[model samples]
Target: MAWGANSRSSSRSSFRNSPFSDFGSYMVVKNRKLQEQFNAEASSSSNSCSNSGKPLFHGVSIFVDGFTVPSSQELRGYMLKFGGRFVNYFSRHRVTHIICSNLPDSKIKNLRSFSGGLPVVKPTWVLDSVAANKLLNWVPYQLDQLASETHNQPTLSAFFALKSCAVSVDAATRLTDQMKSEAEDPLLKGGTIKGDNLS
Candidate 1:
């Protein structure tokens, strides 16, 4: 049977039948460790003479949205590549409050109910920074000028995916030209463009 984007959303059965649909739980727990640490520190510091107050969850968190990647094969491949650490941390019971950004309310509701069925009573990882920076810079994004209609192939997507380290082609080209000029200086002269991003 083929699964559509809305499949696991409506019924608890669909959710239970699929393992990957519940994978977000793992990411949720991973986000909670720091929250627990912050709460603990707050309790101690509030009682002591350390009057300097600090905000926990640091006033903002990495808001993420989830989409059922085209298929489990893609999902598993994503796991092989980026989801290992994200999945492993869900083993902890303290994690709860997963905040998924892209998923619709239907999917969220199904996952919520599933968590309710678990043996442990930890709340669903909803709207919380339970997961740390595990996927901090490793999350996925769309490639520029690509159509989302086609399935993303690892070979092609790896080359075009947008990254946190992205730079403008002009800026990049300029930097390359500067480097080439420095390297090809006259035999009697020398040039070194030190510490400048673009020179």
Candidate 2:
């Protein structure tokens, strides 16, 4: 019974010393460090922005989608500095604007279907607003506008196809006109050229 107890104690000790056991503690420490770093950066940016008078994005909260030009981290810093809310995860109720460089037509349609007319603007809107020290109209920066414009414009292949068809029609018209003119010519008659002999 004593030997059995000792064996059990050794197994417990071995389990405690296992590499897998350290993973949980390591994750906790890492998370804590990341939280502290984030807090420090946020506070510093907010402090700097506070010195610049009123926050440009005071009441606005934005959610970023996919990849962006200035990167999510840089945008987060800008939001903190300008007194805007930057949500890590997207929530329609909490987010006032969606920032994205580009979204596919399907994704744009999906967003429009459920986004309830949420203003999806480019990152330049934020940057330009920061530069101007005032929020610019989001209409000019709307992603849907771009999508609509692209949809309305003819594609390269379609344009080329139309041009080719026009050219073919013009060539056919010219050939028909030449045939009529040749038949009407008094110098040539009975399927004979003016300069040719029928032998």
Candidate 3:
């Protein structure tokens, strides 16, 4: 019985030291610490914003659509922290900017048709502003609509993929040049391109 108990104790010790052992517990502890740290930072930033008496986005009302990077909730938290109002619905006159990573043509048209010419920006605008401790210009953080084969349709990829399709060198060069020009143009920088025919 004593020998058996000793053997069991050794086995348990070996298991504890194994590569896979205690992984869950280790992660739990690490997560707790990270949460604590984040909470502390958030509290401090909130205090700073309040104390400043001039929040970065005091007058700006924002609406989010199709944001995937930091999540809508996370974006709201940042906006609220800096005294910005987050709205559930998009208002042409009331909402100043629409933040989105993805958008449909109907939604884009609705924003564009607005008399105010509502600016549509990417999620990085919020994140970068928070990091800079000020409202950086949204112009640089804007997301451009990549004109694809479909008319007035925006997609993540600028060119539609064609499996085993061969293209002339001149066509490829022209396509590359056009893409480069689009990227550099300030007018086409925002979430939606304004032209009636972009491609």
Candidate 4:
């Protein structure tokens, strides 16, 4: 009976020492901290905006993605100041816009597939809207439009087609020029050349 009790105690100790044993406690503590921080920020932001007159972005909420020009922190401050919500995580029902400077093709495709036509706009849209003291039309700030216009880039298929055409034209021109030169050469005009033997 003593040995059985000792074994049970040892087993309990080992289970406590396992890597995942503290995960639940750790997550609880982390979530508490995050909640506290959010509450503090919200109170401060509300205080600051209480006397600032009407909020420009009262109905807007944004989720930032990747690297942004004004940075996520600044955007968060802007949102809070302008009476908008800055979501730290992507929530399809809560997020009204996605702010990003750039996203890779695969990431963009994934976002588009699931985002249900959420407007992906540049950081400039927020800044310019803040400056103008109103929400501007988002059409001109669309990520796809801005990327193509700013980089002077064509669509993938069009780019490949243009490259193939250029290569073909260059090769054909070189072959045509070589044939014309060989035909005009006087020394080989009457000779038939075959496999390094001339007759």
Query: After TM-score superposition, what is the CA distance of residue 75 in candidate 1 from its true location, in Å?
Result: 20
Q: What is the C-alpha lDDT of each candidate?
A: 0.37, 0.79, 0.69, 0.79
Screening candidate 2 with a backbone cut-off below 3 angstroms (N, C-alpha, C), the clashing residue pairs are none
Q: Model 1: per-residue lDDT, tens digit, 1-199? A: 5577456566667667755457677456545764565445445442211122322222222212254323323322222332121222333243222323244457545554654432221112211112332222211332211223225535555665544236566678899998788677653235544454583
Span of 10 residues, lowest total lDDT, candidate 3: 158-167
For candidate 2, write residues 47-113 as lDDT tens digits.
3343346677877888898899999888888887877777765667768999999888788778777
Count residue pairs with overlapping backbones in model 2. 0
Candidate 3 positional error at 52, Å: 6.5
Give the clash count for each candidate. 16, 0, 0, 0
All models, RMSD in angstroms: 21.6, 11.8, 22.3, 9.3
TM-score of each: 0.19, 0.52, 0.46, 0.54
**How many residue pairs of model 1 clash at the backbone?**
16
For model 1, give the 10-residue run with minimal summed lDDT: 120-129
Winner of 1 and 2 under TM-score: 2
Q: Could you give candidate 3's per-residue lDDT for residues 11-123 as a string of tens digits?
A: 88987887645767666566567446545655566633533568877776777887558888888777667767676655565578888887777766665666265667888
Stretches of model 1 off by over 4 angstroms after superposition: 1-55, 58-92, 104-106, 117-199
